[model samples]
Target: MRHTDLFYLLALQKVEGVGEINAKKLLSHFGTAEAIFAEKSHKLKKIDRIGSLTVERLKDKSVFEKAEAELRFIEKAHIRAIAFTDKDYPEKLRHCPDSPIVLFSNGNIDLTNRRIISIVGTREITAYGRDFCKDLIATLAPLDPVIVSGFAYGVDITAHLAAIENNLQTVAILAHGLNQIYPKMHKKYMSQVMENGGFMTEFWSSSNPIREQFLQRNRIVAGISEATIVIESAEKGGSLVTASMANDYNRDVFAVPGRISDKYSQGCNNLIKTQKANMLTSAADLVYMLNWDLQQPIKPVQKQLFITLEPDEQKVYDFLNSHGKELLDIIALECSVPVFRLSGILLNMELKGVIRPLPGKLFEVI
Candidate 1:
């Protein structure tokens, strides 16, 4: 965006009582941020939702000073400001009614024709969640989806690392400004993340990573992706908030189930039980649900006429054969195999061409 245009947009944001929705409305009527400022007070008041008080606030000239300072910071820091009208702005997020008018981004970030998904969960990630997240990203590597998450500890950082390891573009939505990194400990990963994908935020340089900022940042994380997956969370956490937001935006939501006794699993289990999210056990579930086609055509697997199956693989195959199509959890339960172990057994069966993986983590006999 042009520097002068960005300057006006920033000033528009500083207008008290003017938010994303109202700002967008004014912009629509006037066609540009400059025009909105140039319009007469009576003309602005004629628009719906633009009350007299808001018109008065729009006359505040101090906002221009703040916008100019922010513009200088953006220029010095080499940050790219993505306006709502920019083709480079995230398409999914752009469609959101409450999306920020401008997004500040840095690094080699690219979202062109990319499949984006957000993975969020508890900060106190457990071994099970970590392994699941790693394996999930690894499996999805073939599809090459862009991973989005908060640049925080635990699940968010784990997801980002997994994406980096797989050579996938990973974007970290910051709760604060680009001028500083939060947690301080994550400063080491910043370089690598910037090289691989980059950092994005709607906050200005003056903003800090406070509690409310994180909550507000969650909307971008949820809205920017086609789907949001909860790896693990307690009965209450920020991941659930993202899931709720994704659902509200009419995007698909998935949750990894865990043992009932595990505190971190309670939230995911509740989401599934309450029909708020689909049960996610494998990358196949997400790919299928999102209707994401593989970039390269998958080679057809030919079944060996007399392939041998190990005892565990035979059990899984037999269960799938009888059930027609069964979820991973159900096959594990009926066949008495641990989920983690069953994953390997199922993969082997799939390689043998005796069973085929279906959407939503279901498997069927070939």
Candidate 2:
């Protein structure tokens, strides 16, 4: 979109006393943020549910000032903004009732992946949660699906990092600005994710990360994905909240069963007992349950595909998988190919599902 167009949409989103739903309503009513801004309080007051008092209060100069600062911040961060109506915005989100009018993203992943699975669980995760997430992620890495998570500690970060390890794209739904990384321990990993996949959020730069926003962000994570996976959570964990949102959105919800004695397992057990979540033992189970597309075997494994690789890519693939996961730098050195040209080779391998990507610039043979 044009710079002015993005600015206008952000302005409407920044309007005080105006939430996403109402911002969308205003946009639908006026056709554009510019048009909405031109309308007088009296004119807006005539509209049902938009009282004169609300309109007058919305005219505060601070709102525009905040928006202006936000726009500047966007420019500084090189952040991209998307409106619900924009073609790039996720179609699943646009269909939802409480979709945000404007979203802030600082990454490269397409939000509209063919398959998106959101894995959520408790912060005080368990041994089962860790192992289940790693094993399932290893399975999912070969599927070429995008993974969605809140970038929170425990299950969320595990899923994101696992996606990296698998060469799959991941999106971190943030509750705060792109300027700062939360849970500072994940800072380095988040940077890698930003380059490989992306970060997405509805909050503007400088917005405080609050509990309510985190809770609200859960709905988007659930609504945008095709399925939700709860690895481990207490009975009242946020994972349940995400599952509820996914259920309301008619998306599939799956839970990894845990030992009955563990508190973390209670949520998944209860969800299964209540039929709230489909029992998922592995990525294969999820693939079977969702009827996902597995790679159709090449009717004829043409020797031609590997023949033209100039021998270097083959060596890289052979060596990487030979020892399992490897860093790109190591592969480049092993393959004796310039780092610059390694990109095209990696893309080729990724397209064929021959290798998986991992967090922190690591690569593994599939």
Candidate 3:
């Protein structure tokens, strides 16, 4: 976007009561932010929901001074202000009604035709959640999905690091300005993150990471991806808030189940029990549920000569080889393997290039 256009948008953002939804309505009517400011007060009020008080606020020119300062900071910092309507903006987030008018991004983020998923959970991650989170990213690495998460402690940082280890792009959505990094301890990861994927925020350079901003940031985390996964959470936390926002956006939400006795599992259990999210057991569940296999046609995986498989893996391979393509449940039933254990077995077989998963929860020998 041109500096002029961005200036007006930034100024519009400063106008009192002009939120994303209302700003969208005004922009839709006037066609441009500059036009909205140039229009008469009576004419502005004529537009639905643009009350007299809002028009009066728009007349305040102080917002222009703030916008100019922000613009200078953006240019100096080499930040990219991605307008909602820009082709380069995230397609999924652009469709959201409450998405920011302009997103400030500092990184090599290229969302074009990429499968994006957000993984969020409690800051106090447990051994179970940590292992599951890392394994899930490693398993899904074949598909090359971009991982999105808050750059916080525990699950957030873990997901980001796991993606980096797997050579995948990972985005860190910040609650505060890109001018500073929160937690201070995470400063060391900033350079690595910027090189690998980078940081994004709707907040300006003047903003700080306050309590309310975190709540607002959750919506972007939920809205920016095709799906949101809650690895673990207590009965109440930011991850659940993100999941709720994802549900409201009509996007896919998944939660990893834990034992009822576990405190961290309560949020995920409630989400599943309430039917707000699908139960995610493994990477296969997400792949199958999202039908990612269908997005790109699966290439035939040629089985290598003299490939050794575990006894259980051999059983699955033999069953799939004879049955052509079969559902996971059927293979488990025929091979006498529990579904839980069979998922890992099938994943191993896939990694060995002996078999591949098909759409609709089916697998076949390659």
Q: Which candidate number maximizes TM-score?
A: 3
RMSD of 3: 3.0
User: How many pairs collide in each candidate, listed in order?
Assistant: 0, 6, 0
Compared with the true structure, what per-residue lDDT tens digits does model 1 show for residues 71-95? 9999999999999999999999999
**What is the Cα-based TM-score of model 2?**
0.78
Q: Return the TM-score for each candidate structure.
A: 0.88, 0.78, 0.90
Candidate 2 per-residue C-alpha lDDT over 196-289 given as tens digits, one digit per residue, 9 for 90 to 100: 7999988876777888888889988988888999999897978899999999999999998888898999999999999999987555456656
Ranking of predictions according to lDDT: 3, 1, 2
Tell me the spans in candidate 2 whose CA falls farther than 4 Å from its real position: 294-366
Task: Tell me which of candidates 2 and 3 scores higher on lDDT.
Answer: 3
Better of 1 and 3 by lDDT: 3
In model 1, how large is the Cα lDDT of residue 187?
97
Query: Tens-digit lDDT track for model 3 on 142-254?
Result: 88899999999999999999999999999999999999999789999998898889999999999999999999999999999999999999999999999999999999999
List runs of model 3 lying over 4 Å from the truth.
297-345, 348-366
Error of 3 at 65 (Å): 0.4
